[model samples]
Target: MRSIKFNIIVLLTILSLTTFAQTKVVSNSYSFGIILKIEKFAGRDFRYSLELKSTDTDSLKNIVIKVQQVINDDEWLDVNLAKDVTKDTVWHSLKISSKINPRAKEIWLYANFEGNGNFFVDNLKFEIKTESGDWEKFPIKNADFENNENNPLKDFRTNANIPDGSTIGLRNRTDSIGGKALLIKTTKASVIFKTNYGANKRIGKYCNINGIKIYYETYGTGEPLLLLHGNGQSIVDFNKQIPELARYYRVIAVDTRAQGKSIDNDSSKLSYDIFASDMKALLDSLNLKKVNVLGWSDGGNTGLIMAIKYPDYVGKLVVMGANLNPTENAVEKSMLNQLKKDLKKLQQKQDTESKQMTRLLLMLSTEPNINVEDLHTISAKTLVLAGEKDVIKAEHTRLIASNISGSQLIIFKKQTHMVPNENPLLFNETVLNFLKQEDVKN
Candidate 1:
C-alpha cells in the first residue's frame, strides 16, 4: 500500500510539471490589418512586417513569433509569421511578416514567448512594405479607436483578462546597455496598416520569352518602343510616361523574367546577359526585325548587353543609370548591404515568390561587370541618361557615354535614381524629345 501510494504521487507530479512547461509563454507575435480610419488608407492591401530586439530574462527562453488572420467574429486562421526561427536565449533581432486584407474592415494580432520564464522585448516596431518591396516603419496616426479621438490605445489594442500571467501592452524599461527602452510588451498584440495603390492600375499580358513567361503591356501605334523597367520594378515604373508614349508609338513595356507579373522557368542562375538574350528573343517572337529599346537601371545595363551582342536587332537605344562596374558607381555601399540583408531574410521562406526575390536580389548585389570597350561596338543610335542625384556616380555615367560612339548624354537636374517617378513630367518630355529626334537613319 505504501509503495503504490508513492508511485501514484510520482506520476501525478510528472503530469503537473509537463503541463506547466507546455503552457509557458514562448511564441511571440503581433497583428496588423484593416483599420478603417482615414480615407487615404481605405480599400488597400499591405505587406506588414515587424523587427525588434529581444533579451531573455531566463536561460530556458524559447522564442517564436506567429501571425493569425481573422476568419469570423470568434475564429481566426493560423498564418505563418516567422519566415525562419532559431531558438536562443541570447540577444537577437526578430523578423516576422504578414499581409493585410483590402476588403476586411478589421483584424487582430497575437504573440507569446512560450517557455519557462519571461523575456523583455523592446525596440519593437511595425513596418508596412512599399511598392519597391522596402519596409517603412509605421508612425502613429489617427489614435482614435472609433469616432472618439481620446481612446487610451495610442496605436494598438489588447485584452486584460487573458490568463498565462503574461502582460501585453507598452511599458517603460531599461536595456542591458543602460539606455531607456520603450517596449511594446506583449504576450499578445495588434496593430494597423494603410495600403498605397499606385502600382496596381495596369494589368499586363505574358508571352513566352526563351521558354519563360515574360509579363508585358502594350499600347498605341507607330514604331515599337520596348520599355524595360529597373531592378525590383514592374510596368508601373513607367506609369508617368506610358500613356503619352503610347499616343506616339506602340509602347511595349515588359516585366523581365521573374519580376512583377512574369514567371520564371529557367533552371540556370539569372544574369544580365540572360535578360538581354531574353529581350532579343521577345522581339523575335513578336516578329519584329528591329525595335527601339529604352531601359532603366538594371534594364539599362541589359540594354547595353543587347546592343553589343545582338547589334542588328536594336535600331535605337536609350540606357538610363547603366553601370560598367558594380564596385565603382552601381549603387551606394549601404544600399548593397541592405540588399544582402534582405536576401538573407527571404531565404528562410519556403514560397516560390520569396525564392524569386532571393534570385533577383542576388543578381543586383553581384554579377554585372561590363567592359567599357564593349560599348564601342554597339551599332545603334544610343542615348545615355542619368539623374544628377542618381545612385550611379556622375563620372561613371559620363564614361558610358564616352565609350559608346556618338551617344548623347543627358543628366536631369536635381533628380535621383527614381527620376521616372520623382520627376515624371521632365522624364516623359526628355525621353520623347530624344526618341523623336531625327538622327541619320541607322
Candidate 2:
C-alpha cells in the first residue's frame, strides 16, 4: 500500500533522471554515487546493470558498489551482495544475493566512487523480482517478435517442457505460452539471470473464479493492470501489449473462461456479464480490490459490463473496438462475414483445435447486447479507444465515448480493430498517457 513515490531516492551529488522504464546518472561530475530506493521484499533476487566510460577504463578499483538495508528513517546497514561483481572495466552489474533483511522496508543500490577520478554510467536498470512477477516490457531498441508468416508457430512456442510428442504449429497457441520474458523502454530494464530456468520461469497460475478455472499470468511491478483478450482469442492475443504495458504497471493478462487456457466446466454458453463476473472473482482470488482494466474486442465489451456492474472494482477502463450490440450496424458486416467463413472452415474440420476455434467463433458471432445509454452508469474513468478502420463502427465508438461522462476518445487513423498489434507505439502511448493522468474526475 505504498504511494507512487515510495521509490523516492536521495542521491548524493549525482544528476539522475528516469523515464517510463529507464534510470540513469544524467551528468555526474564529482566522486558521486547514484542511489535508488525501492519498496520490495528481502531475500528476493536483485539485479542491476549499467555501462561506464569513465575518465579511466584502465582501472575499476575506484568503483565500490555498496548494498544497504534501511533500519530506521535515516539509518542503513550494509547488506552482503550474493554475487559482488564490480570488477569489469566494461559494463558492470550488481547481482545481490537473495539474502536480504526481513525488517527492511526499502533497499538501496548505491554506485559509490571513492577515488579522485570521475565515473559515468547510463542504461541503468534495476530488477527486484520473483518468478510469478516476471514480465518483459519490450523496448523499441530490439523488439522483433512479430514476424510470423505462413506458420504461426514461427512466432510463438508452446510453454517450456511440453511432452515429447505434444502438438506443434498453431497448437502452440493452445499448448501454453511461457518463456523468459523482458521489458525494455528507452533504457532497457534487464534481468540478466545466470540462474537456471527454475529461477527464470514466468509466473503462471490458475484460480477458481465463478466456478471455473481462470488462467492468468502476472508480470512487472506497479499499479495492478488487467488485460482481457478478444473473443476466440487467448491471452496471447496481447503478446504485443504485455511487454508494452509491463513497463509501468503490474500487468495481469487472463485467458477468459471457456477460452484459451481457462475452463468452462462443460458450459457451452458465455456472456459478457459472466465474463465480467469471472473477472470480479479473479480480483477476489488475487486479493486485489481494484485494478485498471484494458479490454479489446469482446473483452472490451466485458470491461464495459464490469465497469457498469461492479464500479468499485474498476479504477480505470480502456475499451478498444467494443460494441454495445452484436449487430451489423454496431460491427462491420465484412468482419462478420469473415468470421462466418472462418467458422464454416473450422466446422468442416474434425480436429480438436478446429472444434475449439469454432466454439469461440460461435461465441463472438452472437452475444453482447448493451444499451448505449447504460454507458453513463460506468463510474470508473473510462477511455473508449478504437481504430479509424475498426471492425466496430466509428460512430458507435463515438456513441460510447459521448455517453461516458468524462471518457477520452481516440480513433487511430489507418488502423483496424487490431491497432494494438498494427500500431503498438501509438496505442501504448495513448493508453499510458491516459493511465498516468492524476486529475481525471470519474
Candidate 3:
C-alpha cells in the first residue's frame, strides 16, 4: 500500500514537471507581437520553445523572437533569436535562450510577426535555469489552448487598433502536435505593433508608502507632472497622454494602492483621502515638493482632495469626471444604481479579494462626502474638465467649476466620460493648451 502511494506521488510530480507552458502570438496586420509579462523571470537565464506553422508560402524571415533590455535612460540591448525558421505547415521546433539583465529597470520578450499570413502556435514551453544548472519548466495557464472558456484566447492581449480592411482575430483549430492550437489571422491592413505602454519594465519601480508598495513609471524630463488613473485601472490608462506629456515635462505615472502592480496590506477601507495621502507619501519618497496633476474619474476625485488638503504639493491641477459626493445629485442615477448592484454581488462572495473589492464599491456608493464649498479652498491653478454626457450630472460639474475661484471649465460637446481615450488627440491638445497658457495679469 505504501509503495502504491509513493508511486502515485512520483507520477503526479513527473506530470507537473512535464506540463507545457507558453504564450501565443498572431499577426493579421503589418506587425503583430506578444509582450510577455515576465517580471518574476527577470535576472535569470531562460529558454522559450514552441511548435509553429504558417500558411504563407514565403520564407519565415518575418517571424522572430526579440529580447530587449534597458541599459540606461536612452540605450537598450536588443537581440533577435530563432534565426533559421523556414516556410512550412509542418511542425517546426523553435527555441531561444538568453540572459535577462539583473539591473534592468525594464525588459521585454516578444514573439513577433511582421508580415501577412495565417500563423498557428501550440505546445509552447518556457523554462528557466536552476541554481544547479538544469532547466526547470514554468507553467503558463491555458498554454495549450485546450481550456473550455468562453474565449479560448482569454489570457492573451492584442493590440488595441485593427486598421481598416484588416482581418485580425483569434481562433482555435486542430493542429498537428496538440489537439488544438491558437490561430492568429491577419490580412490587407498594415498595423504597427510595439511594446505595451504601461507594461514597460525599464521605467517601472516601487516605493513603500502607507505600509503598501506603490508601482510607478517615469518618463521625459522637466517640471514634474503627475498622472492618476481611474478606479480598477493602472498607469496603462494614461497611455494616450504619457508620450506627448513626456515631451515637455517629467511624467510620473502611478498605479494606485491595491490596483495595478501596487499591493495593499491593510484591511482598512479605501477612500480618496487615503489615496491622496498615498500620493503625498510617494511624492515625499521622490523628493518632489510640488507637481502638476492630471487625473480621471476616481483619480480626479483624489486629485481634488490633494488640492484641498495638501495644496502645497500641487502646482496646477486638472480633473475629469470628478464628483464632490457619491449621491444621485452628483453622479448619474443609472451609474450609481449599477454600482450599488455590483457592491451587493461582491458582498455575497465573502472572499478576501472580493471583500476588498466590496470595500472599493462601497466607497464609491457612499463615500467622498465633500462639501461643494470646499472647492473654494483649493489654492492651485485648476482646470475642471468633463464630457457633456458625463456620468456626473452637468449641474454638478458646473457647480464644482463655479465654486473654485479663477478655475477654468471645458465640457466636450457630444462626448462621454471616456473622451480621453476616445479622442486622445483633442484631449491632449486641450490639456497642453491649458497647461502652457500664461496666467492673465490683474
TM-score of each: 0.56, 0.54, 0.61
Candidate 2 structure quality by residue, lDDT tens digits, 163-187: 2222222111111332211211112
Candidate 3 C-alpha RMSD relative to the actual structure? 14.8
The candidates, ranked best first by TM-score, are: 3, 1, 2
The candidate maximizing lDDT is 3
RMSD of each: 20.2, 20.1, 14.8
User: CA shift at 201, candidate 2, in angstroms?
Assistant: 4.8
Which segments of model 3 are wrong by more than 4 Å? 1-193
Q: Residues 240-312, candidate 1, lDDT per residue (tens digit)? A: 6787888899888888878877878554577899898888888887888568889999999998988999987
Q: 251-370, model 3: which lDDT tens digit per residue?
A: 999999888888786778889999999999999999997799999998999999999999989989999989999888899898887787777777888677777677777778877878
Off by over 4 Å in 1: 1-204
TM-score, model 2 to reference: 0.54
